[model samples]
Target: MDLDAYVAAHLAEWRRLDELSRRRRLSGPESDELVERYQQVATHLSVVRTSAPDATLVAYLSTLLARARNRATGARTGTWRGVQRFFVDRFPGALYRLRWWWVGTLAANVVVTGVMIAWLLGHPAVEQSLLSPAEVDQLVSHDFEDYYSEYAASHFAAQVWVNNAWVAALCIALGVLGLPVIWLLFQNVANLAIIGSIMIRHDHGAHFFGLILPHGLLELTAVFVAGGTGLKLFWSWVEPGELTRTQSLAREGRTAGTIALGLIAVLLVSGIIEAFVTPSPLPTWARVSIGLIAEAVFFAYVFVLGRSAFGRGQTGDLDAALLEDRVATQA
Candidate 1:
């Protein structure tokens, strides 16, 4: 196709469509013309994409067509219904679809933390290298417990929420590179191992588990979910399978965003547990049970609601109509 000649032939019509789309109001005949021009330009875009494959021209026509489409249909805004659908369908569906990724992450981190704890216990000298005897004594007896109750519950909850949310966000945001997500997860588990090992070695194992399990179970799960989602996003482009790299990335990226949003609520619940339940006068069994129940509820949300949504073909992606049209081409 002679790109210049083709553009010259359609340039006038494209300009006309642009004008109609830009207008605040259109007469009946002009509305009809706008619809007609929209279809024509859409076809032109397809042709240019398939034959000429000019990036600049394809972008121009795509933008022009989008404007015309919005003008023709009128714009829409989010409603309560949309928000309801997101939680009921999109969020759960995403969680279901990406279950293995995060679940594996959670399992692996647990194992690594356990091994690290065992190694540290086996090698007592390692502890002295990290902290002095005075600091260790302070941490084991006071600092560890005081950290939770030092602040008001509400203030601590907010602080925990913000900090955890930032960590989760970083895992997802830097997930595309792959290594960063792994590193983040490692840092998380390493800290746990270090603290857990120290507590156990110093005969504070019960206290440590009592304090940690109350909130750590759910909180760490949320973090693992973010890490797994990030790893999946990285893999999407690396091994796209049937879809083009761009399509796969876009699809996974959208799902990751949904997961990110959903995790806010998850992390909030954990934050509340940590701030209130962890530091409360409740017994260890009671507090740990509460954590267990929260973790169970999360799993049920994924296995029940998420599985059902996925069965109904919800992919946690944008609705098809809302996604931009892609020109099909052979690899």
Candidate 2:
């Protein structure tokens, strides 16, 4: 292609489109001309990109296209329909894409928690080092159970929700540091292990499981997802693949934002169970069943629904068509 001659031939039309796009009012013919020229300039952009690859030309066409598109579509806010699209397409798709990462995080936590429990159980001295006989007996006997009931259910739910959400937020907010995520996960697992070991050592293992399982399943899953997504964000900077570092981080960070919001709902469910369900007088089987059902629904939401959304080309990021000159950002 003779780039100079092509630009010479098309400059007048491009200017006309630019002028019509900039003008406050356009006659019907001019309006029609805007759309027609928009398409023509768009086609020229594609051809130039393939054949001549001029940065300035592509950017000009991209901006022109964007203005025309916005003018055509008009401005919109968070309408009900937009909110519905976000949850259905973006939120779940983000969670599903990051499933393997968080699943691995879940597995690692389980191993660490189990190991800590086994070690604590085996080493009686370790328990003694932390708590005296009287304290240990009190914990196993009443205090642990009482901790859940001492406050009103609603109050306790709010407290638990805030605390758990804070932990999840930390895992995400400090993801760029990477090590903070590991530390947060370790601290959470360590605390759980310590409490579990104390409960088991005093032969209240069954009671502990009965009390915890009703809420722990979904609660811990949310935490794992946060941590996993955070670590993935860190990895984005480390290994950006084909994207520039900034682009990769931008993409993953946006996705992480989706996970963060989705997990709020997930954590809310667990919080409700922890407050009302876990401490209920209902049968242990019934309580645990509720937890299991909630957990199953979450998994299905991410995998089944999220997979379908992803397959439909939902990447949980801003629409590429809405972006200006996406190709210009290429590394």
Candidate 3:
């Protein structure tokens, strides 16, 4: 048969195979066979369209590609069940082999936090240098309890939430450049130092715990996740192992994207508390309790609940098949 006819006969099969692949039910051998067939058919059809420029062939292939793309996107965002399966079941097993990423990120956070604490203890002027006069004034003059209460009531809460969300997103997105990870680490460390210094300078060292602990825990954790993601990207470039830098980066990017999404959720919660809940006229004990609870929830989601919600055993076999098929199709 001619290329056009051959392509026409297989297009329906490709669509059907794509659908089955997404359902996470295909076995490994069957998946590999389908992927091979899909790639062969797609390549031959692509060449045929390129050589003859038949409008019918072009339209058919275009529609097929578009459908495949939509299916992939839908699989990612279609429902809570799918998303949970993807994260818990599919991602962890595929990506958790990169243990160095966890180690490097933890080490970076420790170094940065320690340096910031040391600087605050030794250099009082550094705080004023880092913070603007207005920021310093606001930190000093406002009763944090009252300020937090007012912030919670105002539109400021939404703004802070959106802003922090964007920051977390940017940290992950910009990791594509590699240097942004270092910049993020330094920026966060400097901010921590400035805040620590300001509190100590005002003789509110003890009060600082009540002021920041509520939201700071989650907010800082989100920042750390972002930093880790960026470091992973950079590490791919520095140590590509068997893969090319480009390939390594792409692999790491997929995992980092997942981490970034989880962090965005954390930032949203942190922003709510920082803007509205943290600053309430609640007692110190109440604030401490709430903060501890929030921190516990965040950790539980990341380490415990997140595992159960999105574990590898749930979707690994099917996801691996689909991923292989997609890769083959692209090739």
State TM-scores per candidate.
Answer: 0.85, 0.80, 0.71
The TM-score measured for candidate 1 stands at: 0.85
Per-residue lDDT of candidate 1, residues 295-325 (tens digit): 9999999999999999998878877545534
Residues 222-305 of candidate 2 have per-residue lDDT tens digits of: 999999999999999999999889889988998888888878888888998999998899999999999999999989998999
Query: What are the RMSDs of all candidates, in order?
Result: 3.8, 4.8, 5.9
TM-score of 3: 0.71
TM-score-sorted candidate list, best first? 1, 2, 3
Evaluate residue 60 in candidate 1 and report its C-alpha lDDT on the 0 to 100 scale: 89
Candidate 2's C-alpha runs over 4 A off are 1-77, 325-331
Candidate 3 per-residue C-alpha lDDT over 78-192 given as tens digits, one digit per residue, 9 for 90 to 100 = 7899766655654444334433454466567767776777767787677767677787767866745455666435577777778777777777788777787678767877766
lDDT of 3 at 33: 53
Candidate No. with top lDDT: 1
Task: Decide which is better by TM-score, 1 or 2.
Answer: 1
